[model samples]
Target: ADLQEATVLTATAEFLDDHTVRVSDNSGQETLIADRIFINTGATPIWPNIDGLLASKHVYSSTDLLVKDKQLKELVILGSGPIGLEFASMYAQFGSHVTIIDKSSKILGHSEPEIAEQAKNDLEEDGVSFLLESNLTGVNDTLNGVTLTI
Candidate 1:
């Protein structure tokens, strides 16, 4: 919102000793006379702590890769929860060559076993590879494109 719409109205002022009145600004940033002050910066996505994970250019966040790419030859999804599977399904439908990896033994680990199996079957039938009980050890750039070492 425009600060021009705001007025310097006094909130519940607290006077410490005789000299100072604490102030509040409704719109956000605050200031004090001395050099000491605290400023807050809000949220940013936390990248996984995998080694060399941040250095690669082809490495894209779930937001960028999922929403932007209509089609791709292959995908290596790192998680197998609902969110990761959802992305896998959407991208696979969009004709991405997809692969999903997780440390758990089953794809839908929390779901009913039979249902999860059926879902896994459907996904595999549609060409999504499930790498279960696996760990992503490293990532390497290959001649053709990118290779994810799991």
Candidate 2:
């Protein structure tokens, strides 16, 4: 494949000058000079500031949930965006009790109302719960599970 023949360097890239870039990895460092350079930095999940949430060991970002192989019985998602709803749907299909809380009036606030309602209905049929106009006030990690106060 073309990818197999490509030279891929996994490292932190920094623009040294207009035509130079510095890449550093665990192996060593390298300076690459080119007329044009492209950067493809990925996005990271942003965690909200809720009381006791930062201190809780059970708190996980969306990315963390993707990489982890834990079997969850109950999941409390803090947002109702596309990513959050997707996770809710997946977990609900996996037989987890999924609850999604959002500060808006409905899920997928940026999408068309009818489409969003249809998606919400489908998720609800799958046993997903939604708490609209709700804000997470605190979090408590119990011995058996984590409790979220919304």
Candidate 3:
């Protein structure tokens, strides 16, 4: 395998110049000068500026939901995009009561209207609900779960 000969280091790299980088890890730091350099910047969740959202312990991002071990009996997802629909479908099939709220009038705005309608129908058959043309005004974290003011 070609990857066997390549050096692999897991560290934060700071680009110093066009060809030099300062890499740091828990052990120490090292300066590397290479003809070619690659950087893999992973994804980070973008939270809305809605009130009580950031402070709520019940709120979970897609990444956070991945590591969460708790079983969610009810779920309210914000958005009807590809990722949002994916979560809604998966969770609904998993026996969770999933509801998707979006500002748009329809789901899968980028797709054909007929296709989108079919997808919505399929999701509905799976026990998923949709709140279209709705806006999330605020959030409230109760003893049971987080509540959304739409």
Candidate 4:
């Protein structure tokens, strides 16, 4: 808990040289010597050539829906890629009504057809809904709490 608190403190640094630094915070300023700085912000998600889709609430990047809120009984999910489907499975198992939309006619495209079919059936048995071969025109239906128009 102490480390977590320390990690949240904001500090300003003035570099004296490659190995020397100055730090300022609420307590005041100080100079110190350091060997290196490491940055590990992780991967970036890139979407190429899709217009106006970013503004649609229906278009949730892999990150947004990761934290499942059980109180939300209905979920309209976009995409059937690993990331999207993984969340779908997790949420459905937790008892949310999950609807997944995939542009391709067959989901899990790279997998064998039978494997994909079986997996789809399994998820269906678990009460997950899918709208395959559907192009997301927008998100406008309020009837189901959420819906992706094709």
Question: In order, what lDDT does every prediction score?
Answer: 0.68, 0.83, 0.83, 0.66
Per-residue accuracy of model 1 over 30-77 as CA lDDT, tens digit each:
333433222212233446777667776667776677367345777888
Choose 1 or 3, whichever is better by TM-score. 3
Off by over 4 Å in 1: 1-46
If both were scored by lDDT, which would come out higher, candidate 1 or candidate 2? 2
Q: Which stretches of candidate 2 lie over 4 Å from their true place?
A: 1-43
Angstrom error at residue 40, model 2: 18
**CA shift of 70, model 3, Å:** 1.9
Model 4: runs farther than 4 Å from truth? 1-53, 56-59, 68-70, 140-147
Candidate 2 per-residue lDDT, tens place, 43-122, comes to: 46777888999899898888888786977988989888878887897777777899999999998888889868988998
List the candidates' TM-scores in order: 0.62, 0.69, 0.68, 0.57
**Sorted on TM-score, highest at the top, how do the candidates line up?**
2, 3, 1, 4
- Model 3 misplacement above 4 A: 1-44
Best by TM-score: 2
lDDT tens per residue, model 3, 28-136 = 9999998855343435566888898888888889877767686699999988877788778767776789999999999988888987898899899989999999999
